[model samples]
Target: MNASLLLLIVALLSGLAFWAGRSRSLVVAGVGGVRTLNSLPFYYGSLTAFWCALPSLVVIFLWSIFDGVFIEKLVHPLIAPAVLEAAHGNMDLVMNQVRNLAASHVSAASVDPSVVAAAERLNSLENINRWAQAGVALSFAVIGAIWIWLRINPQLKARAKVEDIFRWLLFSCALLAILTTIGILLSVLFESLRFFQRVPVTEFLFGLEWSPQTAIRADQQGSSGSFGAVPLFAGTLLIAGIALLVAVPTGLMVAIYLTEYASPRMRSLIKPVLEVLAGIPTVVYGFFAALTVAPLIRDLGLSLGLDQWLAISSESALAAGLVMGVMIIPFVSSLSDDVINAVPQSLRDGALGLGSTHSEVVKLVVIPAALPGIVGSILLAAARAIGETMIVVMAAGLAANLTANPFDSVTTVTVQIVTLLVGDQEFESAKTLAAFALGLVLFMVTLGLNYFALYIVRKYREQYE
Candidate 1:
């Protein structure tokens, strides 16, 4: 049977087991009623259902993991030794051909007779494996159901056992998340170490140039590639700084107005409309930046005669930063508004009772109370702006120039990472390995930002609390 069908059968059997366990508990109570039982009928039913499902699922999972390996080992002997020799030790290639031929109804005449025989044998083994897996899983499910059903009694302590099992499941999930994060960090760190071996750490960190085009052949000119990352870092900072300048004040003001001044109806209308920006896809924002905002900025610079004084490219940091700021405004305003609203009404009233104006009360009482969450929101928005890829790729041209001028085109670390890993690339090359180094640096920078934000939060949170 197929996995889906097997799962459906198992679910149905578990449901039946739940009913049987509940009935069995009631019978054992014997006219003293459910109050005589050590646990409730619900707990007895749940315990039976858990037993019926868990063991069967585990069996299916293990079978799926190892069945293919077993079958491949069995099929290996069917292929002729001559054919195996001709495969040049590429067992995976020979196996892929066997699987493809097995999947088709008519075997190709051009294929060797021994390979055809192996394909037929593979097909028979797969069918047998499926039947064996289904039999084992179903048998385990039945045995577990019968065992739990017979054991259900007044003194079983079913509730405690069920709760313990659930607690262990939650712990397993938490451990899985931690292990996954550690795995990612170790993978990136190892690859970055390999990259640093090829290019010095000092040059990667401190060098000013950012070209990463390594030549494939020794005789190629102008493609030896410079790996200085300072230009990319500078561009990233410049654009993110511009975005923060646009988003922070505007978002905070919008939040303050909605919470402290706007009518309920107006607040209801405006908040949802503002938050809709967050739902729009980033690629849509990219299109707006490239097609509309970039041109408008270029034309305005030309009309004002500013292009002569400054380098104004069609794709500039200002356009990307502005659009990104708009995109993240909802994140800031929504979070800040929630935080500001969480300030105690008693605090606001006490400030007003002391003869402070509404604005003074808000500034001294409400903002200080919400300062930690506000800082957290701004930090989140800054991270969002820094990590944005599509808008930067579309609006900010990939010129890796180390300049503070917003009108000049520039590139970011994310864009460079995308550029480096765009196609089929040899992992051993310095150009490809450079992407991992960039990722590790970016991860460190973000970690530092989180640490600083937490420090600010803790310092202010103590006084407010």
Candidate 2:
């Protein structure tokens, strides 16, 4: 249903764009709305299409946001008071179960009569929502068709109208992307706000100790755990630094070999093989890290006279970092290759004409020209490293150690977030809410890096262009 709604929206938006383009043309032709509509027939057509689709979509979106809660509220009261009380405040679970029961090929055994009735009511509500959504979609389709028919006139300056509509539609689409990003940031900001309320924001932000081993039950020991994030942040930087150190030179070299020196046959063979690195799953890399790379690092470090006290476990940051670097090499290399290849052949010939070696031309001209894209690639790779969960969670240690040692065990922010919210916990609690704070921090860091990277790329782009 979600997929269908999105597709429907895209289709509707396309229709609106077409109509807007046509209508704008007519309006530009100096037709007045009061004087038989200033726009061409096509312009009128697009206007009709835009109004029919956009208004309905807005309504559908608004309705969807409130529909589930509204239905749940209606169904909750109908549920037996005894059942509701027995379930306590976990009405959401009960509701979900009821939904599952209704959808299930076979229902789970329910002891409460009210629960069963509620499940039935929930099914009824789902059907109603489905019908309502279907009706709205169909109505919009009909309205769009009618608008198209009415406005599609040969006399109508559709081209002008279409262009105008197109511009507005593009503007709207751009705004939508920005708004979506803002919405995400707002949601994270609000959750982080809630987290700050339960825990002092300063204590959470700047504390040196982190002990998130909170208890679920009141009687259980360690119910109140520390929220210091220093260790996780250190771990993240340490691992990311190691990964970049490994990946950058290696990936850049591969990109150079492919773009500058490799023979046609070799390029054909090697480029795909390198790109194939990206298709390999991070979990596969994790397995390689945990089972293969980690042990290798430990054995190598041990052989290099690192004593047992200088303990480098199989799950050291170096191990995870090395493997993660391997995983991200393609991201750096592929982007670098494309950008390098895009450099003007004339620049290469010009350098060669001056008796510069192939390597020199590449070093002096091609690389400088492609530096923006290369930086963008590195930034993207850094983003991947920062956001990576599976490899870090699997290969890296869960200990929130703040040590700078590459050989020592360390946990990343993603790993901590996963561990923090892994099981049943009240979303309202400090521990659970801490995940949001960590997430916000992670997001801000990544966003800042990306923004900086893009700024550099844009500056260089203007220089070269």
Candidate 3:
């Protein structure tokens, strides 16, 4: 049987187990009163279903993982030595040709007779494997259902057992997340260490120049590349600063208006409209930045005759930062509004009783009460701006210029990482390893921001609480 059909059969069997278990419990209760049962009928049903399905699912998962390896091993001996030698010991390529021949994806005239025989063997093994998997899985599932069903009684603590299983499932999910994070960190750290062995960490951190083009062959011109990363760091900060300048005040003011002054009807209409900005893809925002915002900024600069003192490129950090700010406005506004609303109304009332005006109450009481959450929201928006790649790539030219001016073209660390790893590049090269090093730095910077945000939150939260 196919995997999907097997899954359907398992589902049907589990459902049958649930029905049988529940009906049995109800019948037993009808004879001996409901109070005799240790758990609810629903729990008993769920416990039986779990027992029936869990073992079979494990079998299916384990079989699916190993089936391809077993089939490949079973067919490898059928390929003639000459055909295997021509494949250069690449078992994956040999298997690919075998599959293509078996499926008639490759013409018979294009491949060797030995390959054709190997393909036939592979097909036969696959068929046998599928049948064996289905048979074993179904038999185990049926046996599990019968054994568990026989154990079900009026005194069975089905609810306790089921809840314990769910608790472990939740713990496993949390453990998976932690392990995934650790894996990412370790991978980046090892790659960055490799990069640093070739390029000095001090130069990467403090050097002003930002060239990373190390040629693969010595004959290539410009092969002796600089590894300084200060320009990229400066560009990232310049754009992110502009983004925070645009986003923080605007988003906070909008949140204030919605929470403090706007009517219920106006809030209902305007909030959703504002939040719609967040749903637009970052690529779309990038297009708007490149096509519209960048050109507009350049034209505005020329019209104002500021081109003499301030040179604005068609692609500038200002445009990308502005578009990114617009994209994150809803994130800030929505979070801030929720936080502001969570402030106790009694604080406002108490401030008002002291002869304070609406503005005074908001400034002294409401804002203080909501300060920690507002700080968190702003930090979240700032992180979004820093991590953005599409807008920077589209609106800002990839010329890692070390300048404070927003009108100057610049690139971010993420854009440079992508540029370094864009093609079929060898991972062993310093160029590719540089991407991981850049990622490590970005990760550390963001982690520091989160820690600082937490510190600020805890410091102020104690006062308000």
User: Which residue pairs collide, candidate 1?
Assistant: none
Kindly list the per-residue Cα lDDT of model 3 for residues 1-465, writing each as its tens digit: 999999999999999999988877887777676678999888888888888898899899999999898788888888888887898987778889999999889897888888989988888888899999999999888888888788888988999999998998899889989999999999999999999999999999998988777777668665656778999999999888888888999999999999999999999999999999999999999999999999999999889887888777889999999998889998889999999999888788888998999999888888888988899899999889989999999999899888877888999999999999987666788888989999999999999999999898888783544
- Give candidate 2 misplaced runs (Cα > 4 Å): 1-63, 80-84, 87-111, 160-169, 458-465
Report lDDT (Cα) of residue 419, candidate 2. 84
Candidate 2 residues 116-176, lDDT tens each? Answer: 7777888888788877776776567556656655555445554575588789889999999
Error of 3 at 134 (Å): 3.1
Number of the predicted model whose TM-score against the real structure is largest: 3
lDDT of 1 by residue, 128-176 (tens): 9988999999999999999999999998998998899799889989998
Better of 1 and 3 by TM-score: 3
Q: Give all TM-scores, in the order shown.
A: 0.90, 0.82, 0.90
How do all the candidates rank in terms of lDDT, highest first? Answer: 1, 3, 2
Write down the worst ten-residue block by lDDT for model 1: 215-224
Q: Which stretches of candidate 1 lie over 4 Å from their true place?
A: 66-126, 216-222, 462-465
Candidate of highest lDDT: 1
Give me candidate 3's TM-score against the actual structure. 0.90
- The Cα error of candidate 3 at residue 46, in Å, is 0.5
